[model samples]
Target: MAKMTHMKKQENQKSHFNHISHKEALVLTKIQQIKHQKSMDYWKQLVIAQQQSGFSVTEYCRQQDIKYNAFYYWLRKIREEALESLPQLPEKSTTNPQVAVLSATTVTAAVQTQSSSLKLFCGPVSLEVNEQTSNEMLMQTLRCIKEVFGIC
Candidate 1:
């Protein structure tokens, strides 16, 4: 009788596994697709908000209570999609684009005429550097800026 009861339990389990109808399976698939679309929309909104906020990614993510790694992952995915959508440049162009060439003397004259201060802009962040800034310090500062804004 114990053996017969065990066989009955196995049969019951098998029946439970096979209980879903084809229509029910289709409904489950639709539900999953909707959930996936909602997640994608959420990420897209986050990317847009970050861009418009004018703050660095780290700061923006922090203000929004988002994970830095997850924010970066979504940002990278969005940028990849944007890059893929852009028109491709021809491998061999019929006409070459005009290139501007500046001589050393021209550059020197321009630099001499301008103030000793240098200002660099990256999106919303602006960095001002003077001749007194050390090379190592400038390099380190630029690295930090790049990390925060993903650009210099």
Candidate 2:
């Protein structure tokens, strides 16, 4: 019996596929090159920050000035790749003796901090304020941060 071999044909797929003008291709290639040159650690940091900070993807992207759809697309891509590459995580042990104490302490501290922050005009105001109050102070401050400091 003869062994069978499979051969795949290389079509001129680039021409057949959605083709961009050379100028546009050049621009795209340059952008992709620039993106590739960014450190892997930078992307890892972005993934971790987005995951751990408890922010919605769109909110995080908007706050970080990342393109929204691109962020979500990349996030999904990363997760899928990671799932393929990594071993499954070990199941969490339910019998950890100190978990309850640690969680209770953490929750108590969080509640205390939140209550402190919500105190009416009691916290340290960074700027000296006159009695004249404005309705738009929070909105204005947020705008200033976004525009001037490039913080959102």
Candidate 3:
């Protein structure tokens, strides 16, 4: 009983949040608004830089003094909000075969692109291109390299 009473007293003595003055509250609100506006402006500028330069978000953020984790968090939140706000398209019925066929074609194309990329990256055959060479010149160069190296 004594230990319980002591614990209760200690718990009751723990500090709670103090009330802020009206002036302080006003200042805090203004500060919050300024922070939000600055964040929006930063996002706008960062996005424009990325689109213009074709740099990855991490690279852009490194160049622009933005935190990569914070940028990614904001990006995720933006995507989630946009997806949630978008109106859902009506489901196609099996009776309407054209819509289904088109969707299937799109899905197949996407899958093929994805799988081919995976194969290009991870499969046995290696592929690369020299940016300076034209297609006609590239074949000649490869043929010469093959002749010189002799498939060693």
Question: Which candidate ranks first by lDDT, i.e. highest?
Answer: 1
Indicate the TM-score of model 3: 0.36
Q: Summarize candidate 1's per-residue lDDT along 1-152 as a digit string, tens digits.
A: 24568888899988976898999889989999898657656787777568768898999989989999998887676556545544454587658876779999989976885676889977656888877777876776676545444566
The pairs that clash in candidate 3 are none
Off by over 4 Å in 3: 1-17, 62-65, 77-152
As a whole number from 0 to 100, the lDDT of residue 143 in candidate 3 is 46
TM-score between model 2 and native:
0.31
Can you give the TM-score per candidate against the true fold?
Answer: 0.40, 0.31, 0.36
Output the lDDT of residue 70, model 3: 84
Whole-model lDDT values for every prediction: 0.73, 0.55, 0.56
- Which residue segments of model 2 deviate by more than 4 Å? 1-40, 87-152
lDDT value, candidate 2, whole model: 0.55
Q: What local lDDT does model 1 show for residue 69?
A: 98
RMSD of each: 13.4, 16.5, 18.7
> How much RMSD separates candidate 3 from the native structure?
18.7
Report the candidate with higher lDDT, 2 versus 3: 3
In model 2, residue pairs whose N, Cα or C atoms come closer than 3 Å (at least 3 residues apart or on different chains), thus clashing, are none
